[model samples]
Target: MYDHYDALIFDMDGTLVDSGQLHEFGWSETLNKYGIPIDRPLMRSLAGVPTKATIEILLQKFNLTPTATLDEMNDFKEAWVHDNMHNFVKPTALIEVAKKYHGIKPMAIGTGAYTQEAITILGLCGLDKYIDAVVGADQVKNPKPAPDTFLRCAELLGAAPEKCVVFEDSKLGLQAAASAGMAGIDVLLVHAIENDYFL
Candidate 1:
């Protein structure tokens, strides 16, 4: 039913994988270790943002000078996720949609996750084989809602942004898709509308 779209772009975290809370927990632990306190709600709202950007924003908000390099903070966050993912991460219900279009249409992941992190999680969920391309934080100079990541995925798939539909679970991702000239489908509603398929 998504035949009109030349490509499908999926966001890795809350969209394809149930890892938002896990990521929030990771950020919390990392920040706590640094004696930085953060508003959990604010942290949750930054879901689709890259770790580096999130750290910068948090530091700015708290008026705290970064004690660690951006790379170090990013590394710490990812490591925390890596160590604890087995307990809270898994493919979300949207994998069914991804599987349905696996061979029929080109699909890619445009994520704020680090390249290796996205790769590892997709592999863990058995989704790596289905995704044709992956554009991660490491590959983009700008993160969502900047549109760079999603646009890069469309480029790698040789599809125009207007011809792709991005599945996202966060407002930042939706904004990115719109900025990329692509339609966005919220993962939360995808199931209710799964049968319709945007035909």
Candidate 2:
């Protein structure tokens, strides 16, 4: 099913590796410690959103004034995830797909995760070698649901957006891919990794 594409673009956190749990936990733990109510479902839905966007949404949702600076909250959550990521993250079923396509079609990562975090997770999962480029949240002016990340990835791959396929686990990522004029494969990530739809 993927043969037609010249390049493949992947969303890192949930699509390439199983790190959503750590992210959710980090957010929940940090917010709770700051006396903020936990919204598990919201966090899940906002999986591919950038840290600042996620924080702003949560602040408005809970009607809580920020005690810490936005940078402080972002730093804390990222640190929490980093401290515990090694314990929970592992290669997903899509790693096999990445391996199969490695050195064949060009592959890149376009994620809402900061560049360092995305690179760290890709390295941890041993998927970094398979990818040719990574366009991260810090590098883009707009996050998922906008086409910037994916478009940039396609540019880096020297492929047309329509010739690239995006593997995404979030609705926002799918929207971003579509906005960039690329087809999308929705990698199921609820309880476990499932890429059967494309197989």
Task: Return the top candidate by TM-score.
Answer: 2
Least well predicted 10-residue stretch by lDDT in candidate 2 = 190-199
Q: What is the lDDT of residue 136 in candidate 1?
A: 90
The C-alpha TM-scores of every prediction are: 0.91, 0.93
Model 2 ranges with Cα > 4 A deviation:
189-199
Candidate 1 local lDDT, 111-199, one digit each (tens): 98888888888888888999999899889888889989998999999998899999987888899999999999987776542211111
Q: TM-score for candidate 1, please give it.
A: 0.91
**Cα RMSD (angstroms) for every candidate in the order listed:** 4.7, 3.7
lDDT of 2 by residue, 125-176 (tens): 8888999999999998887889999999999999999999999988899999
**Cα TM-score of candidate 2:** 0.93
Please give me the total number of clashing residue pairs in predicted model 2. Answer: 0
Which candidate number would show the highest lDDT if scored against the true structure?
2
